[model samples]
Target chain A: MRVPEPPREMYEELEHTADWALRVQGRDLPALFVNAALGMMELAGVRTGDEPGEVRRIELQALDKESLLVDWLHELLVALELEQLAFREIELQITGGKKLVGTFQAVPIISMDKPVKAVTYNELLIQESPDGLEATVVFDV
Target chain B: MTQIRKQDFTRLTPYLWEIPTSFQAGMRVPVRLYADERLLKAALGDKSLQQAINASMLPGLVSHVIVMPDVHQGYGFPIGGVAATRLPSGVVSPGAIGYDINCGVRLLSSEVGLEEAKPFLSDLATALYRNCPSGVGVGGNLRLSAKDLDRVCREGSQWALKNGFANEDDIARTEESGRIPGADPSAVSPRAKQRGRPQLGTLGAGNHFVEVDVVDEIFDEQAAAAMGLTVGQLAVQIHCGSRGFGHQICSDYVREFQPAVKRYKIQLPDRELVCAPLDSPEGKRYMAAMACAANYAFANRQIMAHHVRRSFEETLGGRVADWDLTQVYDIAHNMGKIEEHRVEGELVKVCVHRKGATRAFGPGYEGLPEEYRSLGQPVLVPGSMGTASWVLLGTEGSMEQSFGSTCHGAGRVMSRKRAKKTVRGDRLKAELESRGIHIRARSMPGLAEEAPLAYKDVDAVVEVVARAGIAKKVARLRPVAVIKG
Candidate 1:
């Protein structure tokens, strides 16, 4: 599998902190949300290991895609703590009108470095894009 | 990329503007902004306007929602936003008070000047950092059992005083005498209690700090004198709140409010602004929980002040009494109170939700201590680290215009992520040191997020607040050293 680099032009360099964020552009809502989530986890160097032992499922529905993305991530975090499972990757399928169904594969919890505290709404952006819909988000963790 | 168009404003006066209720659906009142041309323009470039507009949609809001000059975008409401809603008829929103309930600033004045304390600057910073618990998830030295935690929640700063954490003078100087009435420990969740159990006196990370500053200038001589502030004197400012306790409480309630808003048939422009009627079960629970958190914060700061005094005594080789280290004032920024404010000619009890805004009640208000009756409440505005903080006195104008509210601080201009990308923490630290500002922090990344450049100019923010007549500047304080969690 090949990992792709996010486009450089999509992100502006933040002046005083230590992370990078990408302003994602997409034609569809689901793609944009997934890209934003990927960008967030990428900044923190989040990755899943190959040792899979358990299957965890999380579902969320919100009024809009922007909020749906937030709810999705929040659900994932809660699952990580409650189920004591560490997942390497997620497969998300959005069925319009604020509903998203996803399947997550997980392994036994291992010692992890750098925990995310909570997500904040500061500097959150969602806008119309030439391709579809676009958004940028900054998480507090 | 598409460029976002700016909204038009209707000027109500020299310092006020109207964001008409018609601007958005479900808005109960118009949004009022308290800022001049420059500040307003800067605010337009940010998301403060959108947040304020969203907050105006809160249920049962009266007259107009207000934002101070230092307004900036925040969760649920703009950081400097204020809204008053009729109690029982109106609703209480946790987002209005913010996650860090009663997050506030406490100023301590000392007779010693910067020149006298220059030689011991490092020692003082080290002492304070050592004595004060800081960093993410760190516990303080004083551990509390369930019984004691309940007492702290119920009594607030009064509990601290009873436990030898403060004195009578400190109590008199504190806002609300360090305890807000109506706090019921039983109303608070067990999770929140568990979080608060070992965290009293701890400084949680991200914008929380203890700074040593010099009184650089006095804008109003008589007011400054009355506040015991003089040019060149040294002072300490501690900025923190209820930590995980408050955060968990807000999280719990924001989730709980979702269904409450729906059940009440309420409409909102933003879901984050979801609320419940003040008289409803959920609303009463939130207020009680909020009071618990507010009291926890008051106790937290009182304990920190005690530690600060002890550190000073230990470092100077004697009691700090001769140093004249006394409590100046403590004021909450993120809170919602049932206050009596005149609305359209009637003195009605309204729930004033001030998120990232300060209550600057004028003189003669019944809440203030007798000693400060003539002087009004002391409004402490802490600037970003390496910038000039200020002490201002509330004025009658505040009551007339803003429900007795004022700007909180030098609001953030740039996002923390943006700031971190532009400047490395190490380089920023070195730059500040070059300019003679010593900074001690638990993490370099944390320090980077709080770089002074990330915020609006404190001088300009203070000037606008003073010129607007809501608050009168008494003293300007320049930082000598900062210890951040």
Candidate 2:
């Protein structure tokens, strides 16, 4: 299932040597972060259970755009593993491309196809293209 | 960044190949590869060689970078690669060490004959699957609070010993006595500790397993005897790492070291290869935190071994005359160690970073335990599922060439997606069962990704290293049962 993203935002899987990679694009940083979260959830194969859990808020601020992206996904992984929550409804706002505050409607995880160990900074770059912000995220397995 | 071909390499021997320093700019050393004909082509099939060249650019590198037969593409540095940097001046890159800190393997030998235990194989696999907590989001058997978790960092396998899960011999036979020195929990991030605390003894998902193997062949009688390997006897292998604890540690350091590269003025071809001077504060802290994860891994395996022992007793204790399992050796494949090696005929200390490579310190090295000192360290090379695992002995040649390191396992040749597309997991399980292998997996798709055909032949990988004299073969193991998360 495709993760819901802002209009005009897109993400696709990229072939990597040993790990999973995704090429994501958005009209802005907020759109990009939203799609990237969806891409990560897709890569991890998150399955939601029948019972809905609760609404959780994840507020994080990174030094830069790349850090912010990593922090966002890493937080989601922790929530899924530690709290057993899988968020399907996500609202994201990137404040001046630095601060990020997100609210997610989460449910219990029924299953995961595989573990994405952690998101890595290996050749991670958030670049501005003609279309908008584009980046490639690599996940260690 | 260009694709490397076999003709690009200079053949130093039938099994040894080298790429001169002129091939890349800012290289402090050349790249030397150990692989045979077919294996050489396999190494060229991906970015493994270019990654090795990228590794050669690290500052203060002593000798040429070493590439093993099982080389494959990996983030930053290639798997089955080794590089040693000069002490105090060299750089430490967490990327080269990998996300799974001290991801290693431990072998346990049992006296239970395979013939006597054949009927109970299915039960044994089930018992192992039930007892050892595995799969995604599965917590460990024991949950440690913040304080107890700190002790897990500083003490390592000793914590398992104190908890009555490990024995004296198990500790003595482990690498670094199952605890790396200089582990400072204060250096580890609070987030890393929180992720690690509840997951201390878990065998997390993806490529991790507990396999029951039967000794199928013995190549070297003396070495096999020392390891207590008797053909037709049951043996257990635990392959895993530090779990999220190590992942968080590596992630934090890799992110933190991003700016350290500019401060040290060390030019890197890849951003993932960010590093700092060995004596720098950033580097020291990374090493300290890495040590804690390494210790946690040692303990993780210790506890898992304890569970393996329990499973053996529960399944075979009554039927078999003796169902006890003894420790052969436990060694970390992904690790960075400070050791003295001869560079240009002069002995000096260097930090050896082995990524997807096993430490094969030769006989007479002071680091080896007493019984193994004369016979050389046992280099455990587990094969792909249902294939033959190997036991090899380190040689003096390894010390001279590969910095006392060798291949880790049957490196991946096909991507997980491709593997999943090509084979059905349920069908694969049935096929393995037909061949006398019992399988218990939390997820069937995870099994398909690790299908035997998706990896390079383990026998061929071992042959290249043995022919190159980095290590010698001792015995071979065939899988009879496997438990995967």
* TM-scores for every candidate against the unseen true structure: 0.85, 0.97
* Candidate 2 stretches greater than 4 Å from native: A1-9, A50-53, A128-131
lDDT of 2 by residue, B391-426 (tens): 999999898888899999999888776787899999
**How well is each residue in A1-93 modelled by candidate 1, as lDDT tens digits?**
112333544433333221233466644655555555555544433445567666666677766665676666555443333344554455667
lDDT by residue (tens digit), candidate 2, A1-141: 123554433887776646777888987887787788788777778888666568777788776788788888888877777877777678787887679887877888878888778887766789998888899988888
Shift in Å, residue A140, candidate 1: 5.6
Best of the candidates, DockQ: 2
Q: lDDT tens string, model 1, B142-255?
A: 879999999998999999999999999898888889898888888887877877887898887678899988999988787777667888888889998988778768767876
**Candidate 2 docking quality: incorrect, acceptable, medium or high:** medium
Give the lDDT of residue B466 in candidate 2.
Answer: 94
Residue B81 of model 2 has an lDDT of: 90
- List where candidate 1 sits over 4 angstroms from the true fold: A1-141, B1-7, B318-321
| lDDT measured at residue A2 in model 2 versus the true structure, 0 to 100 | 25
What is every candidate's alpha-carbon RMSD to the true fold? 4.8, 2.1
**What TM-score does candidate 2 get on C-alpha atoms?**
0.97
